[model samples]
Target: MVAKGKVGILTTNYYNPDGNRIIYGGAERYGLELTKLLLELEYEVAWWQVGTGWQKEMLPGVPLYSIPETGDNFQTCPRLNQSFYEQAVQVDFAIYFVTFLAYPQVLEKSISISHGIFWDYPSFDAVIPTEELRRERLRRLWLAFNGPRKIVSVDTATIQWATTTWPGLWHKFEYIPNFVDLNLFSPSEQERKDGKIRVLFPRRLTSVRGINEAARAAEILTKKYDNLEFHFVGRAHDDNLEKEMVRWSAKHPNIYYYWKAPQDMPHVYQNVDIVLIPSKSTEGTSLSCLEAMAAGCAVITSYVGGLPNLIIDDYNGLLIRPTAANLTAAIEELAFNHDLRKRLGQKAREVAANFGLEKWKRSWAKVIGEVFK
Candidate 1:
């Protein structure tokens, strides 16, 4: 079927079209995937995001409008851009995957999609750029969301947050879970080398991702078991986070780091016996968990935003508080119990099958089609 029309995806995360996967956040993954789906459905897709950093050999027919960089050199956090407004009006449908960047023109035409808001974070006091700057940026985001034509949240946790926090705009909110590619991340029977089991921390090193806690747990667990290996596979976007990881790796020889780029993650996942997501909150769908599950690795994640929707304690995958002791215990439990890992991993692949790409594509096609019709 022909698509409704041109669809513009607005966000702040840089999209490396030549890269295998989107880095760090759920919003980036959603934006990249949505653009691909729209194009597959024959829609004229235009991707707008801050930063001209990426090499621009985007998908065949898609046009990537790299908005001029405006924020602090250290941060690519959203700010109003005149070009965003000009390009948005040209699209038939607009979707803001990273909703904070939306301005009046973009918001008025856009379906604002949010995983959660700044208030969802336990405390931004520790995250970089003065607390004052963080607060001001959030202030702009607060006013932007109020003007969106419609709202789409990735999980029930966010839907509830919207209804309770902004009751007046509750009528505009809807829930649609994020999608994962089961074909690419499918289960593969693994080969354990030297009886070593791998645990993965796939998220970028950041305060919100609770990297300190996760790195600490790896240290404790590695000291206890000689056969365990841990991989930290994300770019340390912050200097502080990179320093912390460096310190942890120095102390824990078992911890290895890998740069984020296009690579065969399915094979990497097949080798991984477990995937750990320790983000405190502010998760849209925790794409790492879904991808790990789809690849048949047992997952242990925090009970933060939208996690409970994906993992049930000790059923499909494990759940825990984003604490060092709790993560250590969960890690120890799965590390020793080979049978439990096999069972949960199998069930996880089943759960992942539900969020396949085709389903998400059809859903967007229907939703966007109806809105424009």
Candidate 2:
């Protein structure tokens, strides 16, 4: 059990619930869930919301402090208020969720859980493509360098990437897999008897995510197979991509689009026959892929980042190249073979059971215990 001491959770934004906003990503969700778990373990929890409109819909009964009238972007100036620092210092441990701005304030015994390595590599600059944004990234990197405590990555693949890129930080690193709520995402017994094979593509419509490839694959498959339907869920990044995706939807009647709500995801999974994650970039361990697997959806994803670690190809899920042709082929193969889909879906469920909330709780408890000790 966690001792009775104040624990502050630092995150980007906590208002937007799961499956709502893509920018408010999985790290924020994990932070909130981790905070809840820590509270349930009997710890005094305090959250510091740096952005406006973030404190409105926080979990009920949780104490949250909003930084007073600072600039809209608190990440740029995280130390604007001295009172926030004083309150944070009073806590036994501070947990920062991938916030580079909070790095300067992190003291001894503080733990930093990074969802992605934004500063140490050049791939991040591509996402933020502006001179001002690049400057901000550099400033954050400078702050992170002079931070009080060392940061720890959440996954082994991230650790390896960090070690390979910036050597001599191996001692400060540890791997903790991202936690998933098993009860919410567990497989349903209701069999999908729909004649059409429903394929789900639940990923942000970003360049790195390769949503265009998925859309193209859908277009190709729709031309070849009549009984195959493609479903896309999640927010689009830019107006152009959204317009193109919407155009694709108009062109193909079998293609369906939905902006999924968190509460509606379980029911959504029941209708999906297969899940596709055709990410071209080095995707971190994707929660959507895991959630799909947990819901007994046959997963077909590119072998990137920690995907290879989670999905044992042909055992739990299928790993295809990040190309439209390959993805289309995989889809066609699965569409024709119902038994293969069932077997893969069942195995995926078993693999997902290992990543349940209970397992994550135990792992986190051990990490916190060791860190505090």
Give the number of the best model, judged by lDDT. Answer: 1
Model 1, residue 169: displacement in angstroms?
A: 3.2
Model 2's alpha-carbon lDDT is 0.71
Score each candidate by Cα lDDT.
0.73, 0.71
Model 1: ten consecutive residues of lowest lDDT: 72-81
lDDT of 2 by residue, 1-373 (tens): 5566767766544543222333535665676678888877777777765544244445676666655434423145556323356657777877766636454466556666756544333465566678997677556644653352545565577677656755766666666666556788877787757688999988877766768788889988888888899998877765576777777687788998767677788778878899998777646677888889889989999877667767888898899877888988898888889899999999988888877878777877776766654
Q: Candidate 1: lDDT of 170?
A: 74
> Mind giving the per-residue lDDT tens digits that candidate 1 earns over 1-373?
6666777777665554323334455565666677777776677877776655343535677766666665632122444345666757777877776555554345344677776544467454555448777766545655656666767777788778656766676777766777788878887764576788889998878767878888888888898899899998777766576776667676777888775553467777877899998888677677788899898889999888888888888888898888889988998899999999999999999988888878877877666665544
Model 1 per-residue lDDT at 76: 28
Q: Residue 322 in model 1: shift from native, Å?
A: 0.9
